[model samples]
Target: MDTGFFAPLLTGYEWQLSLYAAVGIAAVTLIGKYLVLLIPAFRAEHARNAAMRRSKMTKPHYAQNQRWNRRWGPVFLIAIFVGVLPFCLTAGSQPWWQMLLDIAAILLVYDFFYYLVHRFLFHDGGLLGGPLMWVHAVHHRQHNPCRQDSSYIHPIEVALGLGLYAGTIFGLSRVLGDFHVVTVVLTWVAFSQINLHNHDLWETDRFPFRYLATMSRMHHNHHARFTGGNFATITLLYDWLFGTLDHGHGYGKTKVAIRARSDASGIKKPPAEAGG
Candidate 1:
């Protein structure tokens, strides 16, 4: 409790305020991201994407999608992070040191289940039929996802995804006693922000092994050409442990597939990107 500079001052309502604050921060950052289209580079991307659309080269970046998602994303973000979420965190119940444990525990626990859902339900989980995978297919339509594409998910998938997060917090509160409000809010912010970063157009292969940038591309690849592995977000521990940590080598033919993807798409995969 009262971990942040102003959290101590809020007292009884700290958890609720933290929830609202998290929503505000996420909302502002996301809206600001949309404004990046005004930038010259991103504006050029808009033009290229328009051409791609004219030629029907891609369907993931539809104008209707951005319109709807921009309007609805914040609403759902608020609903999940603020409205549906309860003020369940206890007041000064856990020590400050436990906050770290709370963050790690929630992330690990959540990512474990996320890995399962992402691999099994989202990617068919090797079930051959993958009936439920269609709910996730809307997201995978983009091999090279843009930042706006992060929230551009089918509503059903959004429910399942956000539900898992909310369910984790509720479960942790019930099983482990209410966690610190600031901890949960901060964790959510990190989760949301990183989830967006995962969809960015950054070329991370230039970075060293296990670097944050590399890890972001690892997630990007999960949504892109290598839809099978890298199921975990925030950490690769689950992917690595479960043998699903696909970063090119984690899945398919290396040089051949790389060249094929390059040749087919005309977007050359940097040499370092071949194996990520």
Candidate 2:
């Protein structure tokens, strides 16, 4: 809760609460990814993602995205551990219910702000002589983007994107007087995985899980069809509330819709689907 929380991480409650949450989440995610691969549905979803990227010929951008992610991803991790954890986390003062409430509030607040930022600042080029569009345009290159296209953005975008997520945590810290470490960690990890899943090409019509499926479709539509819609990150609630959520972009066959969108948006259309 104090200014210098980093010193405590090595030999204090920060180690047990914060690092434990992160490490446990990482272990579960890494192990669960493999475990889930055994499920036919999940395996097919992954295969669909890979095949979609290949069919759309997104290899060059995909490889470039990977390279940039590998470079900047570690910087992001350092920021999380050194900067964010210290700024937003406390050992374990808050009650479990309060921690849950804090996490929900943080996510809802972050998503609402991100919806505005993504739509205006990033999409329409909000600052610096309108050059943000040029930077954001790189991300729009892949009309039929998949999971690989998620982080394929400029370094400037990376920095600013990090700012928004971290800003939410630090900004809330002042208002809420420091959150529990587990609360911050779970909120951040959920924030991250949701972004990755947004670009995924999977479909799940099940209850709570179906929300992501719907969100993913909307995001793909943002890339492939309606470029100016579905700008929310964590949830589409803002999009719906702000009248930007677009479900009419789906035009039966996906490839045809994407090609049509490219022609309309002036992005170079790929070759016919016969061989594409």
Candidate 3:
């Protein structure tokens, strides 16, 4: 895991060039994501959902919090950019095929780590109370999140989550040698698209990349109904491995069933429903 290879590659203007390329790649990836929304079916679906959200807006505090979160969007982006800057400058010495493999490994590791932190740390109310719980509660306020809500999160939660991602990448680089700048950029681009798409209301199951729909459904379930399961961000591998994969019916169709089960068990209704 000698990272010496990156020393020569990143010297002089090479690191700056790599950073510029990463920014270009990221911009293209974002444009592609917006293009997906231009699809007729997706456009109509988003419009309908937006209307519904407006009609059902009963919580003034939720709107206020979202506005507050929106103000911090630039801060979150800066954190992500700064966190990934180092990885973007390093260049791997491996061949193209090997570099691809290493990139896959990094993404897999990231998803696995994210699943653990999200499930055990972020979502675990018993372990994290007071301000921490309140931070997570803000994100959960949007039962069915739209594009705007995708990045709406408490700053503390953002720092913790991004810190874990950066730490994982940096730690892996030490053990696996310098990862290629291309690999790092591509991985981040894919992650950004997948994360945003998952938060959106679009159903992508019928798309050519079937897995996009699967991941989206899993994340949607986490937000809509089964909050305890489906914790993985880009893939369900960790969730399946951990036996937390909940492929039950969609939230809309299963609300009655969930309510019935809660009532039968003598458990109180969820805060979302209770407040609604």
Candidate 4:
């Protein structure tokens, strides 16, 4: 077989073009998200005060989280690429929409896996125990969750969360063919980018909350109160299906204290300021 003949076919248009587009999109998303957070540091007095307040609350923790991320994030990121590379190298060859659907499939599959894994790791103590809890516990400890410490997960926790999902995606791709790899990776990237933006306090005005409400609520509720629900990151369909949906008390301004009685009543109410 002539390998050289297939090289041009594979490298000609789809692979070269889509790969460049994805990289550019990913970079822009990262830069824009960070700028949104940093912008507040330069605004008017009240805005600067609020920004300083958030910086005080979050900057230190974020610095720490960055330390941990530098130590571990690259490892996991590399592992994910390595695990998914076999299938993804050829991902761009398909039509763009098919590529998108594949990405959606990955996002769906991983979100469910993440929900289940989080449930097991955080909620099930008998299996993994309390030490692992501390790492994750710190993330929920604050009323206003910081994006920096968001991924400061225990190394093992990161491995489990990322590795299993990547492995499962790898296994599924073996059967499903290579079409979805690029799309799946793209969707996951979109989810992560949005997740970071949602946590960024600086984006009070420009951030896209309406677009992210479904999945963002899960993390919001997770921080508001560890009510043992809202596990999915990119989609809440899993939570709604599994009965862990926390409608939260109100808009982003207030906090909602969930209770046994409240849970039993089954009445979804807007968040009250008192809870904050």
Best by TM-score: 2
Name the best candidate (by lDDT).
Answer: 2
Query: Ten residues in a row with the worst lDDT in model 3?
Result: 267-276
| Cα lDDT computed for each candidate against the true fold | 0.66, 0.71, 0.65, 0.56
lDDT of 2 by residue, 1-276 (tens): 764765555443343455665786687678767987897777888898878766554456567666887798778767766656565667756688998989888898989888776777666523433336677777777665677677777777887788777788779888987787677767866887788888887676686568767878778777763244787888878878877766644332444575687789887653322211
Candidate 2 has its poorest 10 consecutive residues by lDDT at 267-276
Compute each candidate's TM-score over C-alphas: 0.68, 0.75, 0.71, 0.65
lDDT of 3 by residue, 143-163 (tens): 667655565677677777667
Q: How many residue pairs clash in each candidate?
A: 0, 0, 0, 5
Task: Predict model 1's lDDT versus the native.
Answer: 0.66
Tell me how far the alpha carbon of residue 10 in candidate 4 is from the true structure, in angstroms, after superposition: 17
> For model 4, what is the alpha-carbon lDDT of residue 33?
50
Q: Is 2 or 3 the stronger prediction by TM-score?
A: 2
lDDT of 2 at 72: 88
Q: Report the Cα RMSD per candidate.
A: 8.5, 6.4, 6.3, 7.5
- lDDT by residue for model 4 over 162-240, one digit each (tens)? 6766775666567667544345546656766655644443333334544443444456656675544566666668877
Q: Look at candidate 3 and tell me the lDDT of residue 31.
A: 85
Question: How much lDDT does candidate 2 score?
Answer: 0.71
